[model samples]
Target: MLLQIDLQKEEPIYMQIVHQIIEGIAKNELKPGDDLPSVRSLGADIGINFHTVNKAYQILKQEGFILIHRQKGVVIHPDAAYLANAAYVEKLKRDIRPIIAEAAARNLPIREMEKLVETLYNEMKGE
Candidate 1:
């Protein structure tokens, strides 16, 4: 998975990990039954403590993005569960609302945001 972690940001590392994984799922970069690196391996790959990766994996499991199999490691779910739950949708809206409001406050036009989103989507899809 492609990820960029910001150590200076206020968000926890585990949350950052979770968010990126979720975005990967949303973008279809990760699919159902796709095996993920073990927490220890991911930590080693990312140069972080294994416990940090474990924490993120635990949350992902609880949130149903991944299923933890004994000895087999974690596997991503095919679809995001965020669309199935009102609370999840609300939480997503709440998370994005601040960023949208901030962009508006900074005089960033909605058209620009739309264009940027379209460009990003196209790039992600290699179209």
Candidate 2:
């Protein structure tokens, strides 16, 4: 899996790592049981600190997106699909609430926001 990190972006490096890894799963680029680079290795590859990569990995593991093993290392969660439950939906809503609020505050039409979401969804799915 490849993660592209933009140092100039507003989001933190660790968040970028988290988002891209999740996107890779969505795109079918990273499958269940697929091995991921070690935190130190990935950090060096992406030109970031090891702790940043570790933070992202810990979050992914906590959220059921990845699994960490002492010998096998890290891999996509075998039962990752179960992550899309009601609680996940609620969390998703909470996460995107700020963006939706900003769009509303800016007077962007609902249709436009819907289109934006559709476009991003398709792109993430590699459609």
Candidate 3:
């Protein structure tokens, strides 16, 4: 997977890594069971500390996005389908509500927001 990082961004480097990996999965650039580069290797490639990559990998493992094997290293989770359980839905709402509210505050129309979401969904699905 190709990861792009901006040191100037306020977001942490590890989060930038996490978000890009998730986007790669969403865009089907990374498939289930695909082996990710070793943390040291990735860090060297991206010019970051290995610990930063390790932190991102740990977060991904905790979130069921990837698995770390002693022998095989890191691989994408084979069963990574998101479960839309109540807790997940609530979390999703909590995460997205502020963004939607910001859009509304900026006077972005509801229809425009809906279209934007639809476009993003379609893009994710490679439509």
Candidate 4:
């Protein structure tokens, strides 16, 4: 998957990597067991420090999104489809609550927020 990093954005570079990789998985552009570039290579390609890519890779590994093999390098997790366990659901809720709160604070009605979410989700799925 192609990744575009914006240095001007307030979000950190590693998060951008994490988001794009996950989005790629969501879009089925990155399939389970697909090999990924080494962290050093991706960092070089993105013009960022290797440690930053390492951090993103570590998070993906911890979250069961990717696997690093000593000899094989990195690949998308083969069981990625089984990742949405109870803990993951809770984490998802926790991660999104702040955005939901911000929409409420801005007086974006629930229906509007729902619509916006649907649009984004559909776009991500390439539907």
Candidate 5:
């Protein structure tokens, strides 16, 4: 997987790691059963602390995006339960609410916002 991190960005390194991994999965660059690099290995590759990579992995595991095994290391989750999860939907709403509110405050048309979202979704799917 190819991940680009910008230390200059306001977002933390771990979040950049998490977001890029999620984006990779969305773009079909990462898939179920695919093995991810070990935390230490990835940290070395990215020139970051192992703890940062581990933190990202732990969040991914908690969010049902990946599974960690003692012998096998880390792999993408084999099932799609995370998509159908009620908690996940709630989290999605919470995450999106702020963006929508900001758009509303800025007087952006709802249709335009919907189109923007659709465009991003399509891009993620490689459409």
Candidate 6:
């Protein structure tokens, strides 16, 4: 997985890592059952402490994005389909409501947002 970490961002480093991985999954860059690098290795590669990576991985695991095996390391959860769970849908609304509200506040056009969503969907399908 390729991730860019911004050490200076107001958001925590672990959140950055988590978002990057989430985006990778959304973009199909990381498929179901794909293995993630060890926490130590990923931390070394990103020049961050291992605990940061571990925290991110634990969050992902808790969110059902990945499975953690004691001996096998971490792998994308085989059944980890996003946007399919009621609880997850609620969580997504909680996460996106502010963004949508802000966009509305900025007077961003609905048609433009629809087009962006269509474009992203097409890109994900490699269309």
Candidate order, lDDT descending: 3, 4, 2, 5, 6, 1
Of the candidates shown, which would achieve the greatest lDDT relative to the real structure? 3
TM-score of 6: 0.87
Which window of ten consecutive residues has the lowest lDDT sum in model 3?
A: 79-88
lDDT of 6 at 73: 90
Model 3 Cα shift for residue 24 (angstroms)? 0.9
- For every candidate in turn, the CA RMSD to the true structure comes to 2.8, 1.3, 1.1, 1.1, 1.2, 1.7
* Whole-structure CA lDDT of model 6: 0.88
TM-score against native, each model? 0.75, 0.93, 0.94, 0.94, 0.94, 0.87
Off by over 4 Å in 2: none
**Each model's backbone clash number:** 0, 0, 0, 0, 0, 0
- Tens-digit lDDT track for model 3 on 1-127? 7898999999999999999998889899999999999999999999999999999999999989999999999999997667668987898999999999999899999999999999998998799
Local error of candidate 4 at residue 92 (angstroms): 1.4
Residues 69-116 of candidate 1 have per-residue lDDT tens digits of 888778996554445678877887997898899999999999999998
Model 5 over residues 1-127: C-alpha lDDT tens digits? 8789899999999999999999988988898989999999999998999999999999999888899999999999997234556887898999999999999999999999999999999999999
- For candidate 6, list the clashing residue pairs, or say none: none
Q: What is the per-residue lDDT of model 6 for residues 15-118, given as tens digits with 9 covering 90 to 100? A: 99888887788778889999999999999998999999999999999988999898999899887676577887898899989988998999999998889879
Which lDDT values do the candidates have, in the order given?
0.84, 0.92, 0.94, 0.93, 0.91, 0.88
Residue pairs in collision within model 1: none
Give one digit per residue, the lDDT tens place, for model 4 in 17-119: 9999999999899999999999999999989999999999999999899999999999999987674779879989999999999998999999999999899
Please report how far candidate 5 places residue 14 from its true position, in Å: 0.4
